[model samples]
Target: MSETHTSPVVLDVWCELQCPDCHQALEDIRALRARYGDRLEIRLRHFPLEKHKHSYAAAQAAEEAAEQGKGWGYAEAVLARTADLASHGEKVLLEVARELGLDAEEIDTALIDGRHTLTVDADHAEGKAIGVTGTPTYVIGDERLDGGQGQEGLRERVEEIADRLLAQG
Candidate 1:
């Protein structure tokens, strides 16, 4: 009998770049990536809250980073300094781009031109439609886990769902 291969489970993580809570949730994201590797498809969906002044721009910068093939790297760098981001705003975004060897000018242009606004807006809208009201929200299958409530047991719950999906596959 021939064996069939099913697509990996998609895990959409709703996040706000300027949010400290979302920064903290990076640990769990890394752990999940390490645990599942290719078995789980983890997607970072932007949900820039109005409270964070620079979050919307940061989301657009993240899209520019993706265009440069340094999406996760740029995000991790920016998320590592949420305080700086809050204080310095767009400057911090450009700094991270330069630090990562990405085209800072291009990122700046992308930001000013609002080229990635539609993408960011779309993600935000989808997040809202799915009831994602906070950063670090995890959506696996039909489950929506809000890490804003608490990070405790979130990773375990994600693992359970991922394992079940992989098993079914």
Candidate 2:
């Protein structure tokens, strides 16, 4: 029987909000998706590190943005504003939300309510269970990748692996 390519290959990504590696990798992943289109399904999973004090809160903030239909946009904005975040504090999250047309007050309320903490915590625990150790870890089935691969590198790598996975049935 021949294999039918009916669905995208699941690309599980574990990342922290404040990790530079994660920020860079997110762009690469974006490129990967743009190039591959429906061939890949990249799921961003939170893995907030211990060192970045605001990483956990950033995760929740991103989730709150997700509730507002701008999760990735808010995340990308936050990542783009990483430098500002250090000086401006977590309020940078709400600023980014507003920049993305999301309501800062709603995000603030979500943060206060801890609306997405469990989701972030669950992702963190799942990442740890799967042997993820750092930000920007990409798991495609049993294969995993670390480091911040540039845009072309990541798209090419993911394209090659996704093709192989799809071909295998």
Candidate number of the best lDDT: 1
- Which residue window of length 10 is worst by lDDT in model 2? 146-155
lDDT of each: 0.94, 0.80
Shift in Å, residue 78, candidate 1: 0.6
TM-score, candidate 1, is: 0.98
Candidate 1 structure lDDT? 0.94
Choose the strongest candidate by TM-score: 1
**What is the TM-score of each predicted model, taking all chains together?**
0.98, 0.89
Global fold similarity of model 2 (TM-score):
0.89
- In Å, residue 149's CA in model 2 sits off its true spot by 9.9
